[model samples]
Structures are given as structure tokens and as C-alpha cells.
Target: MSQAKKIMNDPENLVDETLDGLVAISNGLLAREPGSRVVRSTKIEQGKVGLLVGGGSGHEPMYGAFVGPGLANASVSGDIFAAPAPQHVQEAIEAADAGAGVLIVYGNYAGDVMNFDMGAETAEEDSDIESKTVLVRDDVATDDYEGRRGIGGAFYVVKAAGAACAKGMSLEEAAEVTERVQYNTRTIGVAVRAGILPDTGKRTFELGDDEMEIGLGMHGEVGVERSKMMTADEVAKKMVDMVADDLPYESGDRVAVYINNLGATTQMELLIVYRKVAELLAERGLKVERTDIGAHFTSQDMAGFSLTLLKLTDEIAELIDAPCESVPFTQG
Candidate 1:
């Protein structure tokens, strides 16, 4: 059977029911819009820039989960692996905006770009909110010079932009910082197996035993090329080298590293990637000032991982560390 029926009602109810459960456990920090899954910013303050981010639904702890003081003001949740509607994006922006304008920082998918552009238009026409967008196209697997896709590096971009907004930076400034991070960062991923969509209960793609797809996107989009699996060290070198070549960083360039888990990948595997990747950066004379390893971004239950490196500057460093207190985030 391609699709297996679930125990708790229809598969279509999974997303909404899961969100309802989240709001209950959130201690009132998260509020969903009536008739929509989009989470709104109840903590928005006047004269502060609003930040909005969203995409498909499979990536947990993203879109809505990250909404808090040091993160996104609001995040519009869409269906599993499907982009959210433009109205949801607009609602998120309007709810988060407090007259200081709004910034939409999201992945670089074509649907996201088109829908957010429409949301910006709605914000301009329906309200006094000035909106700007920063597309996160950090995936090095796709041609950066061409129509590149977005991937796990979105976590860093979100962190950087949210920190800036919390520091009272204007929408333009926050967007600028996000754009800078997007330009400085690059990501590449490898997948051992495909994910099974909850609604369908079947694999989105096929993969043979011991096979790995290099440069895979978050959604299992066709990557650089399918190849025989290699050793952890070999895979790390290939992924890191691609990023290094894509950016113009040289010796002494400071960077922050993020090793993302694309769902179902064990922490052990991620650590292996991180360890080998760090060695490559060290040999290149790159200074990795900080590192984050987690499933900050995901593609459902895909057993894969992505490596992201953001060349850092003093301004961005401070911006990323600035304090904010939100439901999902806390400051030192």
C-alpha cells in the first residue's frame, strides 16, 4: 500500500492538529490566526521592525517554532512541502508590524519569492507598512550565479535578521544584514535516503541501499549529481570545497559554522560531518569563531545533512548575539 491510514483521523488533519497541540504547550506565547495556521506575533512592540519567515510545513522548529524575541516576529505555516498562501504571509507581516516597517526573510524557492512579493504589495496598499525582502539562497549545490535554491542555511539568516530587528534596527537595516549573511553564506547537503511524506505515507523519491545524493536540496530536488557513497571525510571535503570556491573568503576570514540535520539523521552523523568539515576549514586557514549543530532546518524525515558557513564580520557577530527574550529563544 502506498498510503497507510493513520490512527488519529484523516492525514489532512495532521498539520492543524499538530499546531493546535503546539499552541497548547507553548504557555500562551504562540497564537494562531483564526481560520489559518499562520502564527502571529503577540509580543510585537511598537517602533520595532517586524520579521517574517515561512515556507513548507515539513521543516519543524522553523516557520512558527522560532517565533520569539530574538527570532522571527511571526512565521506563516504552509502545508507539508507546499508554500503558504500570500494572505497568510500578509497576515504575518501586518500582525508583526508596529509602524517601524517589516522585513520578510525566507527561503529562495520560486513560490516563496512570488507569494512574498504579493504580500509586500498588500502591506503597502492596505496599511502604512513598508516591507522589504531578503531571499535566502545559500544552497551551493544549485548554481548561485543561476537560479539557486534555498536550504538549511536559512537558520543562520533568520538568527542574524531576528537579532538585528530585536536591537531596534530599522527594517532596511535588518534586511541589509540578512542580505549580507545570505551573500556570505553557502550550503551543500548529502542524503542517504528519501523522506516519507506524512500525508501520503510514502517516500518522495527513491534511493538504493548505500547510495547517497550529493548537493541535494531540502525538498529532495535534483542535486549536483547522484554518486556512489563516499567516506565521511571525502563527503565533507567535497561539500566544504564547493562552498569555499563559491565564496571569495581567504585565509584569516572569520566564519560561523552550521551543520544542519535534514530530519531523521542522527546527531552522531551530524557530528561526524562537523568534525571533518572543521578540519577542512582549518587547513584553508579559515577562522571558525562559532558553530551551531542541530536540526534547525529540515526536510521532513529525510536522512541527510547540510553544511553551512557564513563569513562573519564584527557587525554581524554583534548583531547575532544581541539579546532578545522570546518563547523559543533566550539571550545570555
Candidate 2:
């Protein structure tokens, strides 16, 4: 039995209304570009790299929350599970330009690629500004299955890009760093249940109480494999192996670990998964420099989780740890 749904309004109108709320609450630290939902930095510092990132709604602290000092200069938000309109993306690029050029980074999804491509063309209208995009297609399951899917690995890219931009790296330099990070990253996910749409009150998909889907998508798209439920440790191992195999990490390889919640999974469950992942990494003689386990990104109330790993070099490690004071992400 599903619990009753309670939202401000219907699902179709959620994105628009939420953006309104976000702007109202950002305290002028953020502002949406004219006729665009991409939150732009009010204080654009000249000669510093400008960063723009975005995706679907419901993943709150993502595309929007990461806008501020040390993060993205702008974010173009989209409807739930849908890509932002191209015009919005262009506006974001325009708003964040600070004479140093802009780096557009985002998750790898079909709609996103299409719209952002269109946005890039629109950006070229201004020859004085240079722009490039880096796509994070780190999901090992989808990466192996043919269609590239964007999952939890996006947060790491955002964090790294944000730091580089804040450090006043040239647009080309920041883009190169972002691309390198993309090549070194991998992710995998599993879902215990599906999410419900506020408007329809329906589960996005069906799964048996005793079953789970491995490699589930954020929009409730069917996963690569449906299997009998396994123990938390077993599930964690399966997830870790899926990602590690894709990277084929050699012994002693340094990495950063991100354990992202899909919405409904509890912190306690996440901790359990992390414990298994840490032990497994040690068994494989790998070193994890940073382990981030939380709701860094999410689907709408979906009961699941994903693991992302980024092979790290010294330079990338410093960028990852760089301080960011975004509304949602703040580091001392």
C-alpha cells in the first residue's frame, strides 16, 4: 500500500513553482536569468572561469544549490526527469560569462545532450565568448548497456568543476580538467522500490516486495537486471564490483567514493553500504581518499542508492577538496 501524497500542487506544475520558491529563498545570492530558470551568479568576477550545470528537478541541492562562490556560476533547471529548454541553457551561458569564458558541465542523458547542443549553437552567436561542455556518463551499467545514463556521478564533476572555476582557471583549462575527471569516473545503482508521482499517485514502476532492480535510472526507467533481494552487504558488493569492473582499477589506485541516495533509503542503510564498499576496496588493495555518503543527489522519493568512484591524481584531489560556499554545499 502506498502512502498518501502531499505536494504543493500537481506534478506537472512542480518545477515552475519550485523555482519560484528557490528564487524567493536565495536572498539575492541567486537570480534566474531573464526568461530562464538557470540560476546565475549576481557577482560575476572577471577573469575567472564560469561554470554552468543543471538537470531535472527533485534533485534539489543539485543544479540550483551548487550556485555560489566555489561552485557553478549558473544552473539551468528542468522539469522533473526532463531536460531544460535550450533557450534556458543559452541564457545561463550568457548570464555567467565573465570575459574568461564558460564551462558547461552536466550529466549524460539523451535529452540533455540534444538541448545543450542546441544551447551551444546559440552560445556561438557571441564569438567573443568561448564555451564547452563536459558530460559525465559514469554509470557502468548503462555505460555497458549502450545508452549512456546520467546518475550519481554528476555531483563529483560539479564539485570539481566548481573548484576549478573558483580558482580562476581559464575556460580551456577548467574544461580539460572536467573531461579528465569524466574519463576516470564510474557508477552503479540498485533500487529497492519505485517512486510515486504526486499527480497520478502511481509508482513509476513495479517490483515485487522481495525483489530489487540493479542499475535503475532516476526517472524510474527499468533497470538492467531484476533479481531476488540480497543482504545489504551482498548488494553493496554487487554495486561496487559493477563500477570497479568498468574502471578496471589496478591495485593501489587512488579513488574518491560517492554513495548517493535515490530518495527513500535511510542514512543507516547508506552507512551499511559504505562499510561494505570500504572493506571491499581494501580487499582489492585500492585506496579511497575521500568517501562521500549522503543525499548529494536524488530521484523523487525513490527507494534506492548508487555508488560512484573517481580515480584520483594529486591535482584532481585538490580540486575535489576545494572550498565551496553554495546555498546547499558549504565547506569551511
Candidate 1 weakest ten by summed lDDT: 1-10
Off by over 4 Å in 2: 1-4, 10-12, 33-35, 126-128, 143-147
Question: Which residue pairs show collisions in model 1?
Answer: 69-326
| Model 1: how far residue 323 lies from native, Å | 2.8
Q: Give the TM-score of candidate 2.
A: 0.94
**Cα-based TM-score, every candidate:** 0.94, 0.94
lDDT of each residue in 86-205, candidate 1, tens digit only: 887778788778788888888878888888888779878988689888888888876644477878788778888888888888877888888988888888888998887888777877
* Reference-based lDDT, residue 72, model 1: 76
lDDT of 2 by residue, 196-302 (tens): 76656778898999999998777787778999999999998888788888878878999999999888899999998899999999998889999888777777778
lDDT of 1 at 281: 95
